[model samples]
Target: MPAPSILSPRDGSNIDPRSLLSSIGEVVYSWDIHSDGLQWGPNAGDVLGRIPEAALNRGLAFAGLVEPGSGRSRYDAIVSSGGHDHGDGVVYRTRYAADLAGRKMWIEDAGRWFAGADGRPATARGVLRLERQVRDGELGAAGNDVCDRTALIERLEQTLGEHLPAERIIVVLIAAIDELTRLNDDFGHEATDEIITEVQDRLRSVMRRRDHLIRYSSNRFAILLTGCPQNQVEMAARRFSKAVGQTAIETGRGIALVSLRIGAAVAPEFSTQAGALIAGAENALAGAKAGASDTAVIARRRQGRETRADEPSLDVQAVAALNERRVRLALQPIVDAGTRQVAFQEALLRVGHGMDGPFFATAELIPLLERRGLVRLFDHRVLELATEFLAADPRLTLSINVSPRSLIDPEWLDAFLGCTRAAPGMSERLIVEVTETATIADPARMAGILKQIKDRGARIAIDDFGAGHTSLRHLRAFPIDILKLDGAFTQNLRRSTDDRFYVRTLIELARHLAVDTVAEWVDDELQATMLCDWGVTYLQGHLVGRAELPQRGDASALLHATG
Candidate 1:
C-alpha cells in the first residue's frame, strides 16, 4: 500500500485535512517559517491540551507553543524561509503550552519539509500525536511519591531537549532491581512493596538536590544527573551500587538484600533526544546484568533504531523470539577416537521459522538472549527438548551446552535439578558442557552448581577448555568429568608441534585429575590419529559425523555408521 501524500494542494482543498486526520486519531499541523507561527488543526486541542478559544484565534507561534530548548535549531535549519527543496523528515518529541485545565502535555511531532514557489524550503507540515500529559501538581516535592513512568520520561525528554546546547554532560542511569519478581513471589506483594519503598528512599537520600530520581516501573528506577563530571558520574554509579548492594531492606517478612544492575549513558552533545539516551542506557544495563553482578557499563552509540548482529545490542523482536519456543535441535556425533564409534551426540539449538527454513546460529542467538536476561529460559527449553529426545531414543546419550548465566540463576537451577530428578536414571546419559571463558565471573558459584549437577549423575565438561583463561587452580576447583580441548588446539595439531605438546600436557593433566579428555575439530584421520595417540578418549568434528537434524528412521543407521 502506498503512503498517503501530505503534499496535496495546501490551498483550496475541498476535504478538510484536520477532519481527515482526526478521524484517524491524528492532528494535522503546519508551521509557517516566515511568520514563525504554528497553525494547529481543529483537533489539535484534543491532543495538545484544551487551548482557550481566544489563544486559538490569535494564532500560536511555533516558539511559544514548543518548549524553548526542544529542537529549535533543527526546526530553524530544516524549515527554511528561503523556499528550498529539501526532502528531509524529522521525528522528535516536544512539549507544548498547557490547556485551560493547566496541564503540561508532550506530543511526538513527525513531519517532512516542503518547498514554496521559489524552490527554497518554506514550511514543514506534519502530524502531532500525543505521548503523555501530567498536571503540574503531579510532580510535587521530592518528598512525595515520584511521578509515574510516562510522566517521568516526558520530563526527561523535555529537560534533555531544553539543555542539550549547554555542552554540559548529563548522565542518565537506569537501575533495575535484580530479581524483583522472585522477591514478589517468595515474600508476597506487601513485602515487595515495602522493599521497593525502602529502596526508593535510599535512592532519594543518595541523590543530590538537583538530581532527578524517578520510579521508572515496579522494578526499575530512572535517574538524571546534571553538571556532574565524568569521573563523578562513574563514582556516583559505584556509590549507588554499593549503597544498594550492601544494605538490607527491612520488609515485614525479614531482611532482604537487593542487588542492582545499572546502565549509564552520557548525553550526546550532537543530539538530546530522550529516546536515544534511554536506549543507550538500556543496552548498557543489559550488558551489566548479563555478566557480573552489581556491575555498571557505559552506553555505546547505536547505529540506528533496529538492532542486528553488527549493532551493539538486541531489539524487541530478538528478545521475543527467544521466548517463543521456535527452536529445534541439530545433533552432531562425538566419536571415540580409537574405535571410531559414537560416544554421544551434541544437541545444538537452531532458531527460525520452521524445520527447513533459514535459522539463526547459536553464535548469533546467544548474545541476544544474554542481553535480555533470557539465556536461562533458552537453556531451560533446550533441556526440555533434549529430555524429549532422550526419552524417544533410549540408546542415545546427548551432550548439551549450558550458559554460565543460567547456572547462576537459582530458580532455573532448581527447576533444572527437578527435571533431571524426575527421570531417575536419565542424568547418567546427559553431559552438560559449559564454555571455559564463561566461568570467569564467579568460579566458586559455578563450581558449586557443577557439583550439584554431578551429584545427580550428570557429567560436567569444561568445553573449549584451552581457548580461554582456564588455569590449574580452576581445574582443581571444578568437579569436571571431561576436558574438551578447544578446536583451536586440534585444528593446527597436525602442523604445529606446540599445539601437539599443549594437547599432550592438557591430556596428562586431565589424567592426573581423573577427568576424561575430548579433542574437538579433529577433522581428518591424521588429526584423529595424533589425538588418539595422546590418549584423548573422544573426538568430535565434521570428519567424524556432521551435525544433522535427527530423523526417527535414520537413528539406527546413524549409530551403525559411527560404529
Candidate 2:
C-alpha cells in the first residue's frame, strides 16, 4: 500500500498523487475483511503515531477505536453502497473519529472495495488522511453544531454541481440579530455568547437536514435553504425570525428579548454563483437592518430570461396576426360517454397559419398574455365569438376558458352582458372553464366571478382537477356545473393504481355535488372505456373526435344547419 503527500490541499484535488510511498500527510492500507488482517504503508506509523500499532494491525482493533456516530463505520459505507462494480470494486469515502494520544482527530478515509462471489465486500485498499483536530467543544463555535464559513461554501458548491433538473429553487439567507452590538456591550461576551447559542439552537430546530445554518460571524448566521421555492422565501424567513427571537432568552443577568433580521436571495434567479449569492444576501441584510424589520428582503438581480433584442418577438407577431383577422378557434368536441354524440365544443384559440402551422396556440400565447393583460382582452373577444356561434345555430354549445386575472378586469362584465344581450340564451349554451391553479391569485375573486356565471344560465367547469388540490367546499362555493378531470389523471390510468382510485373518488364526489364529469385526453379505447365504466358523463379527446377547424366558408353545414 502507498499514499501520496498532500501539500495543503484545502480542497480535494483529483490529480493528487495519493498512491505514492513518500506521502507526508496520508497513510495507505489494505484490509482483509474475513481474516481481520491489515497491511500499512511506510508512512502509516509516523503519520498515525497517536494510534498504537496493535490497534492499527487488526480490523477489529481499529473498528473498536473509532468514535460512535451515525457515520462512524467505513465497513457500512463499503457494504451498504448500491450496485456491482464488475470486479473493479466500489469506491467509498467516509469520515470517523478516533483517539490520537487521548485527543480526538477526524480522519477522511477513501477507498475501493472488492466483492467476493457472494457479492459482499471481502477486501479493500484505501488512503486515510487527517481531516482535522478536535478538542472538547471544538466541534462547533461555542459548543454548538453550527460550522464555519468553509462548510457553507463547500456545501453550496456541491448542491449547485449536483442539482436535479426538476429540483425546487435554492435560496440563501443571511441573518443577523437586531442591536447585537448594543446587547454585547451591555451583557458582555459570556452573556452574548449565550444569546448566540439560543439563536443557533432555534435556527437548527426549524431547519431540515438538507438545509444548513452556519455561524458566519460573531452575530450573523448564513442559512442555505436547499429546496425552498421562490414564493415561500418570505414566509420561511418570517418563520425563522419568530423561532429565533420570538420569546425572551434567559441569561445570567436577566431575561433578554432579541429580534432577528434576515435577507434572502434565490439561486439562478438572483444569482447562479455561490459567492454572488452570499453577497446578494448580505446586501439584502443591510437593507433589512436599515429598515429595522424582522421580515426578510429578497435581493433581485437581472434575470437571464430577459428577451433578447435580436430575437424576433412572438408577442409582436401574434398581435399583428390578431389585427390582420388571422385568428380562428379550433373547436374540440366533448361528447356524451354513453351515446358518443357531441355534448359541446371546447374552443381553443389559434393565431395565424404559417408554413410551420398556426403561429401559436392559446396555450403558448397565454403566459405572454397574462403578463400584458392581453388574456382578458382575448377572453372578451372569445366570449363575443362564442355568442355569435350560438346565435348562428340553435343547437350549438361552446366552452370558453377565462383567465383568473381576466375576472378582475373591469370590462369583463360589460363584454359578458353585451354577448348575452345580443343572443338570448347564450349563457345557457356557454360553459366557462377556469384552471384550478390560476384561482390561487385570488380565490374570493374567483368565487365572485363564478357566481356571476352560475347566476346567469352559464355553466362553470374547474379545469386541471387534482393539480390545485381544491376542497369540496370550494367546488360548492363556485357553484360548479362540471368537473373536467385533468388529462394527467387518466394518462397513467393503466399503470397507476393511485390515479385510478383518485379519479374514482373525484367522479363520486362530483356526482354527490350534482356536477357533470368530463374526462379530457381520451386518446384511446382503453381510456374511454375506463372512464365510461367509471360513470364519466362526458368525454373529450382525439379518440372521440379531433378538434376540427370550420372549413373555408361552410358555416351552415359545419353548424349542422341549412337554409
Candidate 3:
C-alpha cells in the first residue's frame, strides 16, 4: 500500500478528492480541501481509527477535534477575519477533544489562513498534534518548568490573609545552593536534584496546609507559617527539629543525612512586619546552626522588658560592672566527716545592685557570666579573692568551681596559675571543682586540663557526682583527686536501701583508688555518723561550719562552735 499525497489548490477542474483511513496497527488519516466541504484522502480511516469507507461516508467533522465552546470562538474569529489570506497568515490556538476508536484524547490545533483571487480570505489549513509529552532531551535545561506560578501566588495571598495580618506577615529568603554545590561536585547533578526533591517532599509533609512553602533557590526553601503566636513559635520549631532528625534521604550515589538548625522569631515579638520576621529568624537560625546539634534557638529582641531565654539580653552594663570589682565573694565551708574539722571552703561569687542585698552562690552567677562572655573575668577575680584569704589563714583550704569554657582557655589557666604563685604559699591549699556534666562533653580534653591543674599542687574534684549519667567509666578515666557525692545520694541513704548500697559501693571504690570522698548536705548528726561510718572523708552542710569570711582567730574555732 502507498501513502497518499497532499497537494496545494490549483486551476479549476473536478477537484477530485479521495478518502482513505485505516487502523492496521497505529491509526492514519488524510484530508483534502476544496471549494465546498473538505474531502478526505486515502488512509483517512487509519488516522481517524476507523474504516476507509466510513471516514469518506461521514466526512470528518473538524469541530469535533476542538473542546466545546473553545474552538467556536476561534472558528468565528477566523471566518470574520475574511476566511483566509495568502500573503497574510492567521494563527489560531485552541484546545479540543478527539474521538479515536470511541476513546477521547486532547488535541491542540494550529491553523494558517490563505487568501483567494478576490482579495478575500478563502481557506485555512492547519496541523493538529496531541499535547502528550515532550522528549527529555528536547525539554532542554529548563525541564518541564512545572511550577504552578499562579497557584503559588494565590496560595500565598490566601495564607497571609487568613493566618497573618498584613502588618505581621514576613517572607525570608535564604540561598543554600552553595551547600549543594559541593554535593553536586562530589556526586552529580542528578544526585543533587534527588536530594532537593526529597527535601521538598519532607518539608511539605511536615508543614501545615496553610503554610506557604516555596523552593526559592536550588537548595533553599522558604516557609511561612501564618497566624503563629509570638510565644508559641517554639512549637513550630520543634516540628522542624524532629523532621530533620527522622528523615534521611538516599541519592543512590551516596546517602545524605538530614540535619537542620532552626531560628524563629514571633511576629510582634521580634518584628511587626514579614520582612523583619524573616531577617530575625534567619539571624537566630544561623546562630543555632553555628552552635550544637539538635537545637532550635529563638531570636531575642531587646525592648525595655526583662529578657527571657527566648529573647536577646541587654546586660552589657551588668557584665562591665563585674570587671570593675563590683562583684563580691562569699565562702561556704566543707568539713571533715569523722574528725568534725573544717577541711575546705567553697568560694561563691555574688553580684549586687545597690541595695539589693547579697545574692546566693556561684552556680547562679556563672551562667549569667557565661552568657555575657564574662566567665573568665569573674573566675579570675574570685580566685584572687580566695588566694588572699588563704594566704592570711595558711591552714584553710579553699574550693572554687571552674566552667568548661574557662578550663579550655589557656589565658584563664595562665592567669590563675600566676595568681596562685603570687599568693604566699596558697597553691597547696586550693581545690579546683569541675562539674561531672560539663566534664563529659569532652572527656579527653577535660582529663588533660585536670592533669595540668593536679600537677600544680591543686586537688581536682568531680563536683555533683551521681547526679546524672556519670558512670564508673568516667571515674576510672579521669585523674580526679576527690569525689563530692551529690546531696541527693546522702539524702536517700536513710530511706532507700538501693541508695545505701550504691553509696557504700562508691565509697569502697573511691577508697581503693586512693581518691578522697566528700558527702554534701549532711544536715543532722545521724546522717553525719552514718556517712562517717561509710568512710566519707569530708562532710559539707549547715550541721558543720556555715560559709563565712575569715575572722581574727583560728578558722578551726568556727568548726568547733558548729559542732
Q: Please provide TM-scores, in order, for all candidate models, with all chains considered together.
A: 0.44, 0.45, 0.43
- List, residue by residue over 22-90, the lDDT tens digit for candidate 3: 111111112222232443323344345452344334323444333231122223223322222213233
Worst 10 residues of 1 by lDDT: 80-89
Give the per-residue lDDT digits (tens) of candidate 1, residues 222-244: 88988877667668887888778
What lDDT does model 1 reach? 0.64
Error of 3 at 207 (Å): 50
For candidate 2, lDDT tens digit of each residue in 162-266? 663556578989887776545654775458778878888898899888887776434567888877888899999988999977799999877788888888988
Let me know the TM-score candidate 2 reaches against the reference structure.
Answer: 0.45
Q: Which pairs of residues clash in candidate 1, taking residues 3 or more apart in a chain or in different chains? A: 83-119, 83-120, 83-121, 84-119, 84-120, 84-121
Error of 3 at 332 (Å): 1.6
What lDDT does the true structure give each of the candidates? 0.64, 0.68, 0.55
Candidate 1: stretches off by over 4 Å: 1-324, 552-561
Q: Which candidate is the best by lDDT?
A: 2
Name model 3 segments beyond 4 Å from true. Answer: 1-314, 360-364, 549-563
